[model samples]
Target: MTGQLRAAIYARFSTDMQRDASIEDQIRSCREYAARQGLKVVETYSDRAVSGASLMRSGMQKLLRDGRSGLFDVVISEGLDRLSRNQADIAQIYQSLLFAEVMIETVSEGAISEMHIGLKGTMNALFLKDLAVKTHRGLKGRALAGKSAGGLTYGYSAVHQITPNGDPIRGDRTINNGEAAVVRRIFQDYAKGISPKKIAEALNVEGIPGPQGGEWGASTIHGNRERGTGIINNSAYIGRQIWNRLRYVKDPATGKRVSRLNPESDWVITEVPDLRIIDDALWEKVRTRQGALKSKETGVPVWDRRRPRTLFSGLMECGCCGAGFSKVQKDSFGCSAARNKGKAICTNMTTIKQKDLEARVLDALAHHLMDPEAVTAFCEAYTAERNRLASAATSTRTTLEKDLATTKRDHGKLVDAIIAGVPADQVKDKMIALDARRKELEGQLAQADSSAAPVRLHPKMSETYRERVAALIRGLADSEGMEEAREAIRGLIEKIVLTPRADGSGLTVDLHGALASLLLLATGAPVHRIARMAAGGQNDKSSAGAELQGVDMIDKSVLVAGAGFEPAAFRL
Candidate 1:
């Protein structure tokens, strides 16, 4: 690589949040940075109205590709926060720069600053999260207000109802087109017992582009392929329209609005005088056909036999045979008897008790997942140490610069003295000493400036760590009135392997999931003792369960180093 440095500047702003004029502010920052380093501002990149959550932006991808081609020795951004809202994506970019020997710099924070990388990427990721919440909130509000929250459906187009000047752009009040025809056709197909997948195929065969002007998706065809701008639950395809079938009301406890499709008893029938799309008797016959076929496929209601429920049933499989092990009991979840009875043909019947074993697993989770306060403490500790190293590095860099300047002057002096007829050996010795000193100083500077990365959790992030631990704990401690929370945890811990005790006693469970197992160490709990469930299959008595004790584990910072969680993942 050439000794002279070159860099590219990347500036990005969301047009949704800031004015287009703000682009100039970023350009100014890049110019000033280039001037400071005496490096060429060979390229400037910007993405407008584009999220920093991904490099999906066309301009941003081009900037990265140019960097990969070794067009520049460095990439500078206004700040690391502007580069990405995702820490993972930021890390990917940082690693990719290694291929070209490219350094990353930001204004205020100069080249190859490792400490700022973590801090800035985290800030950007949080910003992205906030933006997502804001967008979701707005969409939810519009949905509640019966305003369009999605793209124009299959039969409808989104056109301006009011102009920028607040002028009526349609029919003074509004204009409704006869999109009614397209909607009727879709419902007619559904009523004719055509599957949604089949309907999609038919539409594709007819070369009909969906609402997004792309190939049809089942959900797209279902949600928007309705016959009219009126309520989507129009029963006209079933020979009648039921007014007020689905009711919207605010939930009493949460104060959040929810929708419920009401029973037929509550529906009000109304006959529409609009252009008839299909004969009522034909539509009624199609509806009956559809319902009968659906009932048969789903199994008739009365004949639906209830199956015994178990937490890990059908999920736990033998490591050898890989056949799912059915739960024999809450305390002893074991492999299926059919496979086990056949001896070496399959796998051993490993069984584990449910109680004590669960506690040890929870304890492990508590330790590894780390409370937010503890994480914050660790991070604070790590951050302080990093700053100290950076200070030492900066001091060494300053000293190197002085040494380089003095070496250049000494070289000149040695040459001049030789020309003035000083002994050749003396001049040569002096030059050698200066060169050695210069090399030593250069080595010291490189050693100092090279990255001593901070105590980074990296892929083992605080948020994900907290989530995984909390989930495992909740799954084991599925207390009364916590059904939803339990299910969430079950999804996280895909499976648990139980090994029978050496003496043919209850089993010892080794919880997998790399992150989940790590949490066990964090809590300082290693082993669990499992006890059999009662005959009723509810749970064992006398044994205790692990509880969060009202601390919302969700918001606890696994990286923070203190206790007492309040609401959100904030440090104490």
Candidate 2:
């Protein structure tokens, strides 16, 4: 707080070919810069083989979350593009960090301002788009030349061409007889009347490895047929190659690539006689059978058997293996990994009935609110904290207004003196100096107004927190408000860790989130005071030690102590 500024270092590289030492090199440069500026490097974050086009990278998310939590005074990165390549994402990140009073310093741009975010962000975004276009064009050329455009396929080995400079250039692929024999068997068996499921089972029985060195499943033999991904369905096996049958684009919500079918007009079909494994006669027979099977299914009457949506679809996780808990049956949720594979894959085979889990969560909430004294203490602490933040914003606004008045008044006097009969050059020089100072003051005032403290819960909101929480819990029992109630629970609870009982009868539920923080505040310790003590490098454990008891305590003690008291989760 006094001498050295605390800095969090962020580094990123976009491709796997880049050495792992890239992160270290970036951090080393940042450390040198920090030392020159008299800053203390407190933490470091990095993302490897991650595209900067999005902010979905794990390290970037952690950096932003920590920034909001006020964990450090400044963030240092090698460049603005190292943080993000998307212009909109750059702007959002800049505003959020600025509002939190944390400065972002880059080695290339120095301390980032709105101007840097705008100009550098646009440049980075353009770079990404141009690079994508060039890469696509190169791949398209390779495909048209009957060469391997991407990774090696299942039944082939890559053929490399050595340049005069002794550098090997990857081009075409040659058949791998060992894997090609297996591929031929899959096509022959499927064409001879064996189902894909039976073929997979036969391969597994023979101890044959699947494409990726794993046990084969029916889906592996019959992948997205339109995209030419499956072993038997691929046209490359029959003297023809299909390229660009599908294209991948990033999903906005998850930032993961989702494949969509490209029109047949866009596909590049090439004749590669050397790559053929199956004869045209066999391929035609297999295609005819597949068409027949599809036609039969298309004629069958479809049943309206859509399953009802569950309340805790994405919230549950297994305590044993840390795998997601998915709805395995109509009324039960089980370990997804175990259910998808076999019980042998995962040791924890516990299943929880949906009704039981819901009841326990509601019961726990009711029990926690039963104590009036604890509720009163939390409400009072939360209300006072909100008022304090609002008061700070008001005070800062008042000071900026006073400074603006004085700057304007001095500017007017300087202008009047210039008009009166003073030497033109001398008066103009004075006036220019005054005008520059006035503009600086105005900029400062605008920033102060724009960076007003974040909105927090008022007294009125806190007073009704108990009733709203109770109503939400009770509403979970009704079918009508189940969706709203589910969201309410998720807002209050970060995750519901269900540790299976040793006896295998039930689960021990552990709650985490803003409500858990209330356990610490019930003892009358203010969150801001604890945060201040923490910021000053002082340890304060008395609050949590006295109030939070037993083994059900949530993780991240600092987060619990510093989180604001807002009832947004309790709102219906």
Candidate 3:
């Protein structure tokens, strides 16, 4: 309609398993299409692993904003579906662009008219509905057959290999023994009335990664209550497969996805007792406690919302039982597990005076970080220990590099063999096997490289590190902004596990992450030695518990201290 058409490109993919290159491919096609139409491509926007049904996507929003600003006369995409699969969302997007006098051109559909938008949008929407129906039907069938219907769960791995006929063989959820042990531990701990937050802390301290191979969150372990979903509420743990408990529906107004609870009658419950991870008694205990907590939360007054309790609200955990320490009474923090189920349920029954805990934490921060002598001592010890770890990891790195290179070479050879006319079927199997090995080796090498890299002190460590750390501490400490302070603490400390002294004298402050590194630096203490000192070696899992205790206070503090702390074992 105007001079050389200025076009903007939009591309998206719904899931990460879809190659990231899908976005690039879509953009490439759109550019080619624009070139053919004598259009000048001005800008390109892409949202990877984002659903088309949701306009909450950053790229989509930016495209809309730019369209409104009259930055482009034409918007180009690979297809109408790339813009949106939801009929309402597509109509809205088309109208918004049309109102701005911007025209949409899809590579497949050419220029979009009002009729094209109406018909194509409806068709895309219908296609999505049909896909959902087919997916649900297949999942329901799988559930009936006692097979997993979705992604791999925490304790189980999906059997991924296809059958000879190319049909994916189902009903093959194999329990990962290593992860299963952690699952059992979670059930046991929860049954004993240990809070999810504490359990997460214990797992982190023991260097046991969660489902996503990262630090665990309470939500990840406890799950959502409305849907009766999550690792804690999953009926799969009780030897039953519950399908269709929740559905994600796109909101017409916002073009965003919202999760809705499905009716019980609609849920397809399947019996698979052999698949159960938690025992009946443990499941019952956890369920009962969860029900009680839900009731408590439901009755809480609006004014008594949980967020305002303290600066260290979610960061504190019961050192003994690994349950979260929550604000029990005014100016006091106590283990939620102990408060809910009594001291009989949890041994960490002592309530910490909030002011006292806060003071000690701040003091520890100043003493270990702000003092010039302490900073020098910490820097020296930190650098020495880092060098030692780097030396130890050198051999491991070399071995992994060799393994990766060999696997890649073998993969290249297999590819060449296939090109040279081996039986395609036989060669295909070998290629798959070789590719899998190559991926595994590459992963190992990548991990090795990351771990082997030394955590170095800032260049200003000798001259200005102390002043910088002190200023950072003061900025957080002097601020009345609870959110800012909380955020700073989160960045500095991985966790603060509070162990009530068995002698009833006081609480032992165990630091973790960067905090531990800083302390090790200041004290020139070995990891286990400091951990023992912090934990007082009072409980079972003495070494682990002790290490956990010592590690609690410091966590990500190394980063805060301007002396980076990697969670290397041999801390000075």
* Cα lDDT tens digits for candidate 3, 293-329: 7436476422223555465667687878888888878
Report the Cα lDDT for residue 284, model 3: 87
Tell me the whole-model lDDT of each prediction, alpha carbons only: 0.53, 0.68, 0.68
**Candidate 1 lDDT by residue in tens digits, 507-554:** 555443222222332332221311121121222211112111111122
The deviation in Å at residue 54 for candidate 2 is 2.1
Best first by TM-score, ranked? 2, 3, 1
Evaluated against the true structure, the overall lDDT of model 2 is 0.68
Write down the TM-score of every candidate: 0.39, 0.60, 0.52
TM-score of 3: 0.52
CA shift at 169, candidate 1, in angstroms?
Answer: 13
Candidates in order: C-alpha RMSD to true structure = 19.1, 10.2, 20.9
Model 2 ranges off by over 4 Å: 192-215, 295-572
Tens digits of lDDT, candidate 2, 6-73: 99999999997789899999999999989988899999999998988888889999988999888899
Please report, as a residue range, the 10-residue window in candidate 2 with the lowest summed lDDT.
551-560
List clashing residue pairs in candidate 2.
none
